[model samples]
Target: MKIGRIETFYVPPRWLFVRVESDDGAVGWGEASLEGHAEAVDGAFEALRDRFIGHDPRRIEDIWQVSYRGGFYRGGPVLMSALAGLEQSLWDLKGKVVGLPAWEMLGGRVRDKIRAYAWIGGDRPSEIADAAKVRRDQGFSAVKMNATAELDWIGTPRLFDEVVKRVEAAQATGMDVGLDFHGRVHRPMAKQLAKVLEPLGLLFIEEPLLSENPDGLRQIAELTSTPIALGERLFSRWDFKPFFEMGAVDIIQPDLSHAGGILECRKIAAMAETYDIAVAPHCPLGPLALASCLQLAACTPNVAIQEMSLGIHYNVGHDLLEFCSDQQVLTPEDGYLRIPQGPGLGITIDEDAVREAHKERHRWRNPVWRHSDGSFAEW
Candidate 1:
């Protein structure tokens, strides 16, 4: 029952998977993929291993507390992500030991399935109409796409017509569209963009302005009735509290792997529930991360929709199900992902495939974009 070893595998398409083993032969898996910074997150595990080795694996919360508070310097992407992976593995271990799914341990499920969404257009979106149709054919009722690419600080209103056109094209396919400004829009543009896109009845506008500018976000929220979804960058409940308090956001999209793991996100969801906000986790990573998100969705009532990485543009050579043994557990049906009934995170990892893929670990980095004037733009 004591934690024996902790190992991290850098897998394909930019993912870091952690494997935790107990002295008594229990094994648990978690993902700590921090997109472009997998190595930093992987490096963070060095301290986690030092702290958690020989400790009780079943003490999930204690491990989390120590990992976070004991570090003295905590709550950033790298440290929290590393802690998140370890925390998820501990839950996986404890769930398997008890012969119950993680959700069952987390007060059972509130829904049998959650509505799921897929990414339509690539980072620099184009031809979204066709992509939306493809997603509809794939049984997804909703799709998200970048609203614009590398926008200038203060562009003309005409720049948004194409955005409206793309959204119209997707909505033409009878699919709900969520336009992600991707924090590429500054305040001047965000207000205009949010005002213009308000008529489309979007599912949400994600990161119209980055979380750093809460005042800007609040202003955009006031400008439009569209559900302002953010928190992909905000890592914890402390980070998310102000948005809820200020009425700045309608939906919180905490990334399970980047935020603190399952329990932490569940707590965040509970916090959002008080504000009557919805939860739609941001998961553009691989299987383990998606499975971790599903676990949260299974138990939390506030979770409205789920985002999956299946066929997302970032999954270059390897897709979401590459290293998963039972893809059906994570697959979408009728535009919803069924609650995983299996113990732990509910999907089995193909360990051999993971180990094999680790040999050729990917050095994936998000594309860097520049404005027409050569100033750096958010990607």
Candidate 2:
């Protein structure tokens, strides 16, 4: 079926939703939430709408190739994210048309259920024990939290101790804890923090140093045993090539929504498989993004765990599953999210609610942080 109409909705609390309809009236939904930059992604879609309208919806790979190579300037957060959302919509529509789940179409189910983790301790990250307990009671076996707040390029030893204590508090609940440095820690401290947290037995240390610092990451990798998990920032498989080649990462967290869509991520996971690296997709957006992750986790063998934004800090007024017709479809059970067995992405969207929420339109932006000396610090 040819694509007839495509639409994007900038929902509250920072999310970008995509809807695509075939000429015959079949519809599909996908999320391209770029967190702080929804508007840019929405604008990037203008080019995609022009390119893909009246094109065949079932030609997923062909459409992706044209979208990527057709545009001389390609492969970044904005354009890739815009393409990612539209690509996911095409897959969903194809899966529905074929009367099979996306995973089934990819290959077949490799696992019935995939493990999931919840976010706690917000951006600054404190009072983690209570937060961990709450997640444990909610049937989560693991939880992740930011390692620290804004920090100077070089901080005192006490700052390291504070981060350790926060992680220890979360671990006290007998739950697996993954510490996300969130690129807030620079190379000087990133190496030190990884060394210090090496003894914690963490599930993983996410973005310890940012993906942009490959040399720093390799040095940090040499110093610590903790699985260096990054790649949320790397938008394409080409972007992830160096880290894998350097043997610097143990677990790669490719965001399905940002690192191209389902098929592209599957290909990335395949490349990571040769290095024996694990896949724990970085999804902290909405139900559709998480659902797309589940579809990948279902067929890919290396996927270690999935991140859900169910109660994440950034989702101020709107939590995950807010726009889903059946929230339970994407809901985690006993710490593991079951692969969706339904057609397409499996979860049904509440288009009416999405359209209604778009009316107010969120202008959510990430808070800019400054060091004690007033210099810019990563947030």
Number of clashing pairs per prediction, in order: 0, 0
Tell me how candidate 1 scores on lDDT: 0.90
> Which whole-number lDDT from 0 to 100 does residue 212 have in model 2?
79
True-structure RMSD, every candidate: 1.4, 1.5
User: Candidate 1 residues 264-293, lDDT tens each?
Assistant: 999999999999999999998889899899
Task: Give the per-residue lDDT of model 2 (tens digit) for 1-379.
Answer: 7999999998878889999999999998888989899999999999999999999999999999999999899899998898889988888898898888999999999999999998887432356888888888867899998888765478888888888888888888888999988888888888888888989999989888888788888998899888889989988899989999998899998888898899999999999999999999998888888999999999999999999888645488677877888888777788998899999999899888999999988999998977777787787
Cα lDDT of all candidates, in order? Answer: 0.90, 0.88
TM-score of each: 0.97, 0.97
Model 1 TM-score is: 0.97
